[model samples]
Target chain A: AQSVTQLDSQVPVFEEAPVELRCNYSSSVSVYLFWYVQYPNQGLQLLLKYLSGSTLVKGINGFEAEFNKSQTSFHLRKPSVHISDTAEYFCAVQGSNYKLTFGKGTLLTVNP
Target chain B: GAGVSQSPSNKVTEKGKDVELRCDPISGHTALYWYRQSLGQGLEFLIYFQGNSAPDKSGLPSDRFSAERTGGSVSTLTIQRTQQEDSAVYLCASSLGGPSGGYTFGSGTRLTVV
Candidate 1:
């Protein structure tokens, strides 16, 4: 079984400020990590994914995440944030069995 | 033509009524999934269908929830005896299977039980 833990429920940051959303996972088997963002009344959209190879992976909308095998973490980061970046983000892990497990989610609120 | 599509963007039904939500996955997609998202929360997996094989219903919250995929493309999720607690945005996503590519999602159906 695989489980994701997104430590923060909400994060508020000023415009153009760097921010990081923490995520950790627990799995006994090999895992694939992902980050998804959802706007109000919209469906979830994939921000990025970490399948294999390099530990650091870049994603759309100026976002990036690093896969840490030892730490069991895949934290999302952005050099700077804008008002448009305010949304709900979810961290997920797909286990060896192909079941996708998601964390509770973190809400990013960027204020101008 | 390129993305997953969902129908009946909004639905309002009586508490005991049954409702059906539809999803049209991307063309040639072999894996389809259903999920539910309540206000201020993340998505909860409901079921998954891969090709013509049996769907994984392990995430279904109860027997009242059921889903079916025909022609390995479109899928319909039915909720019987809908309750207030059942009101949420039902989301549908499609992927090529495996972990390589990210899943594409539809706009989702907002179900409101009155």
Candidate 2:
């Protein structure tokens, strides 16, 4: 079974500041990792994913994440954040069984 | 549709009533998924459908929670005798089937069981 853990429940940042949302996963087998963002009442939007190859993955909206196999972590980072970046972020893992296990989520609150 | 579409953007129903939520995946996308988001508890996987094979229903919480995909395109999630616990944002997503491509999500149905 695969499980995901998002380190923070809420993160408050000033606009244009850099931020990182921590995520870690536990799985016995190789798995795929993903990061998604949810704004207000909207559904989740894929921010990025890590399937194979490079450890660092870049995603939409200037967001990026690094997949550290040894540490079992896939942390998301953004150089500069905007007020529009304030949203709920989630980390997910998909194992061979093909089921996506999501973390509780981290709410990003960017203030101007 | 250009993206996954979920009907009944918001639903308010009395406890014990049955409710049905619909999802239309993007055309040609073989994999469909259902998830529920509650207040503090994050998104919970409910079920998955891929092509003509059987669906992975291991995530279904209980017998009251059931879903069906017809002709391998549209899916309907039926919750029999809904409870307050069932009140949440039910999200639907579709993918190309596998790890190669991530999933595309719909706005979701906000179900409020009174």
By TM-score, who's the top model here?
A: 2
**DockQ top scorer:** 2
Question: In candidate 2, how many clashes are counted?
Answer: 0
The lDDT of model 2 is 0.95
Pairs in steric clash, model 1: none
Q: What are the lDDT scores of the predictions, listed in order? A: 0.93, 0.95
Q: Could you list the iRMS of every candidate?
A: 1.4, 0.8
lDDT of 2 by residue, B1-114 (tens): 899999999999999999999999999999999999999999999999989989999989999999999999999999999999999999999999987788899999999999
Instruction: Please tell me what DockQ candidate 2 reaches.
Output: 0.89
Q: How large is the C-alpha RMSD of every model relative to the true structure?
A: 0.9, 0.7
